[model samples]
Target: MAELQDELTATAEMGELAELSSPTEEPPAPPAPPAGDALTRARALLTTHPVADGYCGLPATLRTLPWYDLELGDSSVDTDIPRLRDGGVSALLWTLRLLPGTAHAENPVTAVLEQLDLAKHVVAEYPEGLRLARSASEACDARAYGRIAVLMGPAPAAAIGDSLATLRALHTLGLRVLTLSGASWATEAGLTRFGEEVVREMNRLGVLADLTGASARTARRVLAVTKAPVILTHSGAHALNSHPDNVPDDLLVDLAAAGGVCLVPCSAERTGSALGDVADHLDHVRRVAGPESVGLCGAYDTGAVHPDGLADVSRYPYLIAELVERGWPESDLAQLTWGNVQRVLRETEFAARAAALRRPPSTARIERLDT
Candidate 1:
């Protein structure tokens, strides 16, 4: 910890503090939406499939948009989904819109529900997103948001001004989990004593607490207070990936011990799409928390698309191949792919209710998919 602090302090004091994007430093404009053969090639690779008859339809919260961000060129998204899918991922734990902040989120849930035909994931929500969820089915029919899971995060209990009202709104909108904060910062809900009271309230209302993107201090404090299993949605075990965004392996195990599930998000923030990086987090979690505790909270940006390294979701399968080569057990693979996340979601009241709801295309839940 001291080492990291020193590194940061030295960097800051050296007058190397970060600068806002000057006109030139700005994200290079997206190359003309990948036209002609390039567009065709990209589409061919990222093709999505609809659910087959008898196959359970994706939960409303798990859909992703048709556009993949990596194609646009982003640095933070990971290549794990393509790689992990190679052998077979158990289930998709989508925390779409990513979680840099309310402002930094990308790929809205509605986008996924309407497009992104390949796979599905759960979503994290922002204030605007919450409002959108209220009528995603209707909006999409008009060719708007695709809509998916609300990786619903509660401002740390410390943060929520009107807990009862906020949760009531979330429940009305069908939000399942609330992570409490975005990455790195602490919220009021994550505050010391008062936070616990909020957790109690969330638990009563059936909201799971998400601990990912939480300050390390917040992690230490929040876990001590909450009663329900917390989720570190879309995160990596730090021991291996070693990024600030990742939870340390020891901490991940502690989260599991506290009965929380740690979601290994497949983004560049941690392993940068190295098959080894993906495997390392999964392995660490499995070794410590056992199978029941870990799952993927994928935050891939097939839209903005990273550089050559972790790039597109087309590369998702590569991770699976690496796991297989290492002789990973098939059962374990199942857990990572879908089993773990499924268990987590299903156990939640929201999933159970959603499962009972109509999935038939003509059924009410299926509004005309937004264009």
Candidate 2:
């Protein structure tokens, strides 16, 4: 991997970009469009910006769960945001959860820290991403509404010396969320006293401890030691799917009690098949953790051939509509769509962590708030 400076050292050409579009930045009005035809209006100007002007083509400029498949390059630096913004994804979380034994062309920590420039750029170029980044809003903005973030990893903390520094660096980048353990088990937090120091540091830094692919013991010990809210970011229900990767109901409840959530998805790790059976795990977490702390996220575009009814990112509105058809309250559906994540991102206390690092923030605060 190449050494990347913290600053978003863009070539001079990129420096001339205009401020992001705002309500005041709209084109002069013409005739009004119909209710469902709003997307047509949005699609008309999807390519307004040069970088985004001719990007991903779809029926309309739309948002989805931002995808995370970055290769180390100049394009990698800023490629995701424009597509994510154009895709209608309000919040973008890069799924750079490194697989085990995948050699890095560069240092992994550098990869994450380099993103700070990216975060700044996203905010600058797409203020909507900044609002989505800051407020974690669910309400759609005409241009954009999503925070651009990176998944902390499938990496174990032991992989990086002074892993606390990585957590601190990520938090500084406004990376408020991270997974507990990833698929490959190289140097994960799981190895270090069940990641006690890592979890403690993550909690202190206001980072989330995701328990997506962890063992029961790893999950429990992490829950026990971590002061930050822990989450099962995405998984199947062990109660139903019974896959090792699926989280057991008991742990699910513990995560909920800790003020965290369980993200159920249609991925094979959770659902065994690519059925995109979001509801199976959603309902499962609902039973285990209750309605408030349960939610959904699909690891789509893996070419993993989705089961019928759930093929692409565009299918999300259908998922929400499904939740509604099941007699679920709109409030709960909102939580599933965006509220729970919003709570996690906004309510998390990174300022204290940063403050503590400057001097010392109370670790006890993490315990108090986490429980």
Candidate 3:
């Protein structure tokens, strides 16, 4: 019995020595909590690469409520200073007029000028929140200053009334985008002779031709004639929605080849009322037109209902988070949100400079050219 007890004591001592010789190990790290969720990653990504929204109809809405204080946030509107900041939107191209064919103003030019004035006044009133950006560099500068860059225009081309000089005047008044609209320009036969001249002058002036509601023929003609990249500021993939305003795949390919961007809108009429529906359109655009050719626009304050997850400006990160969940790389998302639009604006400026050196301002009149 004593021998057995001695043996047991020896065994206990051996076990103690083995325990002392063994290295202690930490418990598994609980999987590190995934580093962050998709939404967190999306917000972080947007900090470096903020969204350059292609369209916002705040100006048009402001025209009606001239006294509306944007600083105090408006529940009636989808856009406001607080919401814009929350959205991580660094830049916006504010439409200065109603959609084409909808404005029944006796003088469309005068109406557009009124909207432009209102937009400038609003920007000036909220200097801390907004900065008027005339170029891509200016927009980036605004972002650096922690301000939202507001770019105005693409008022109906008809607003200029077939006068290239009027177009120049509008540019002088801060018109960076000129909508190619009206019955004569966007028909099946394509741009009239005057329309081509207007596009040429726009190229020389550094104005982007906005093909928001243009027909395929007009889009093709502009692609063929303009030396600068164009933008479909608020559109979707027709293949997905079949809306007349949605761009078809063939045009998207042509637009991509021309170094243009198709800014996908969150309009439920075109993309449905679901967040996945908007993402689907975005994916379709990216697939058909390539990554560099896709962009985002909330189309807020435009009298159109937005998708479920993207009902207002503040929901942009949610869309980005959805894309992140779909395995989109950071680089591609960067281009989609910011880089592509900035590149388009930069290229448009470059094309204008080159065009200016080659030709004088066009004096071509609609009466003389079209008739």
lDDT of 1 by residue, 1-371 (tens): 99999998998766543454345466657666422443333223322311000011123223333333322332343432233233122223333233334332343343322322223122222221212222223222222232222223322332233344555454445444555654222453445343444455555555666776677677777777654457766667777767766777678668777766776655655645554666677778878787777765445432322323334444444544455556656566556544555454444445324433523211111112211
**Per-residue lDDT of 3 in model 3:** 100
Q: lDDT of all the models against the reference?
A: 0.46, 0.50, 0.89
Q: What would the per-residue lDDT of candidate 2 be over residues 83-141, giving only the tens digit for each residue?
A: 44443334434343322344431455554454444445433554433332322333234
Question: Which of the two, 2 or 3, has more TM-score?
Answer: 3
Give residue 36's lDDT in candidate 1 (0 to 100): 48
Ordered by lDDT, highest first, the candidates read 3, 2, 1
Best by lDDT: 3
C-alpha root-mean-square deviation, each candidate? 23.4, 19.5, 4.5
Task: Tell how far residue 7 is off in model 2, in angstroms.
Answer: 88
| Local error of candidate 2 at residue 125 (angstroms) | 6.6
Model 2 lDDT on a 0 to 1 scale? 0.50
After superposition, the stretches of candidate 3 with alpha carbons farther than 4 Å from their true spots are 1-36, 99-104
**Model 3 per-residue lDDT tens digits across residues 1-371:** 99999999999999998877777944456755464498898899999999999989888777666467678898878899898888889999998765446554657888888888888888999999999999999999999999999998668776787688989999999999988976465566789888888889999999999998887788889999999999999889999898988999999999999999999999999888899999999999999999999999989999988888888999999999999999999999999999999999999999999999999999888789877
